[model samples]
Target: MKRLTITTLLAVAILSGCSSTEEVVPDVPPAELYVTAQQALQSGSWTTAIERLETLDSRYPFGAYSEQVQLDLIYAYYKNDDLALGEATIARFNRLNPAHEKSDWVLYMRGLTQMAQDRSFMHDIFSIDRHDRDPEPARKAFRDFKRLLDRYPNSQYAADAKARMIFIKNRLADYDLATVDFYIRREAWIAAINRSQQIQKLYPDTQAARKSLPLMLTAYEKLGLQEPIENTKKLIALNPVN
Candidate 1:
């Protein structure tokens, strides 16, 4: 009886150990989870896709698939129109995997986020009507595009970034020229000349600067600034587009 009782206790111990091991074991592999997330993305279920990808990242942080999931999470956020979250996730991915294969894509996405955050023309019109021209978003977009150009000059998005930078620069120059025009209208020739000089110095190649030169020349004449008039002439002769 004692031997039988001892055997039963041993059997119970073995069964308990097996049950514990089974409980600890994962039901689905990380790869399976990743595939499900991809399927969710393909199905246009962005929230679910992001959730699964995030889960994979947390559970299998050091796996090769985790890195891919991190990138996928960025895309998922972008697809969901969550630009702020997408940017944040991309930044985190960049910090973790600076040398990742898709780092260029991350940079490009960041630039796109900045572009998206820019105020619309309608908003600009509203602000202008209210005499509250908030140009901060445009300025931020310019800075972000500049960063992309400087850091990833050879990236696939570099050309687009450069084009956008040119566009932003032109807009900025236009704003400056408008201010100078206002000063000229007020007979503040010195102020007008200074504003034009500022544009010329900062954005020599912009069309706004070219357009401002003739006005600048007029301002210099009205202000009786001979040296500036000659310098303006020299600039026009050098540029030949004014």
Candidate 2:
């Protein structure tokens, strides 16, 4: 009798625990979830906001706040430093709402997500042309920002986008100059000259292009190429350092 009574109590306690666990996230109304997410966001609880917004987004795809929930989720992902997820959410938002009035904001966020990628120096030196190299996130950010400006010239985001595009352009020229430096280190004068010339051709306005001219002159002198040396000198004279 005593054993059977103890077994029954244990079973009841287990069932009660399971019930409490199951009810932790009961099917709440969409408004309730949205409010919870909004509170979380207001409190700067990014993780909680993400959880609630994700749940809200899933449970109420066509609900009144569906679009807002998606936007919130994208922002939460960004705040959480989960850039890959933020990028995925941005793509989904764009796909589902091609004509959204806030499309420019989405483009802005997408550019930020791309620009936030790793920019550390690589273990392997880059020797290839800028176009031939792995498509850097900086380049993608530049393209996305360009699209934002082109599609919505008067967008509030256009000024910032143009600024970032300039930064990216300079960054790209700097990377190309790194290749030029690597070629110089290897005593590959012709390769260095080619990269430097390409930098000037592709990035005429960049400081790196101006910096490359002297390096190109060095290569020409090393190769005993008199005419090219004089031409490079003339070019350098035209663009003296400020």
Candidate 3:
């Protein structure tokens, strides 16, 4: 939903015409295409890998390397920043091979793809405050990684998934903190206090919670609530961010 329409049609487009300029001929044998795709992947040429893999997929549906081709194509899409195609291709792979042994890897890639979505090169170069950005991609990535762990606890990607989940949690906490800051800047004391209290309750262990303690105290002081201000000060004292 974030990128392109997540539908079977998108999957078809991923197979048929992923690259507008590079046309892949269907006459090539699947093995040759697989070899070429592998070379492209090894050389870190994502566009070339995607072209060869898509050709193999469309031309030889049940070919010997179909499963691997789909997986490789998904990886290529991610490397090329073609997140929507990667997502759609992942969905297609799960639909076709429900119980495939590599499904755990696919799940990890799905999370990785969503995690890498909506990122901007300018944002990376600039010291941008991105807590204001949409948190849906982080949420989706969290969900994907959670599902991966739920289904396959022993997966090779489990450790990295757990690490990503931690970052996702911090991202959500930061988003909530950003909203609290918005209310604070607007002089909406009650709204800010409410949201800051929510942050303290929901993410008490997070760095946002540590930041929120002061914000909540500020909100309380602004509202002339001495008791709340004192309580928030105590929270800040008790929870020192290290």
TM-scores across all candidates? Answer: 0.60, 0.80, 0.86
The best-first sequence of candidates by TM-score reads: 3, 2, 1
Query: Tens digit of lDDT per residue, candidate 1, span 22-133?
Result: 1122358887888888999999988778778877877888997977887788888877767788888888888888887767777777766666555443455335432124
Report the alpha-carbon TM-score of model 3 versus the true structure: 0.86
Model 1 earns a TM-score of: 0.60
- Tens-place lDDT per residue, model 3, 30-108, is 7777888899999998888888888888888898888888999899999998999999999999999999999999999
Pick by TM-score: which candidate is best? 3
Write down the lDDT of every candidate, Cα atoms only. Answer: 0.77, 0.84, 0.87
User: What's the lDDT of the predicted structure labeled candidate 2?
Assistant: 0.84
Error of 3 at 150 (Å): 1.8
By descending lDDT, how would the candidates be arranged?
Answer: 3, 2, 1
| Residues 1-242 of candidate 2: C-alpha lDDT, one tens digit per residue | 98798678768867875774321444788898889889999898887888888887777788899898888888888777689999999999999999999999999999988876634223212333343244488889999999999999999999999999998888888889888988888989999999999999988999999999998888999999999999989999998755
Instruction: Quote the positional error of residue 44 for candidate 1 in Å.
Output: 5.8
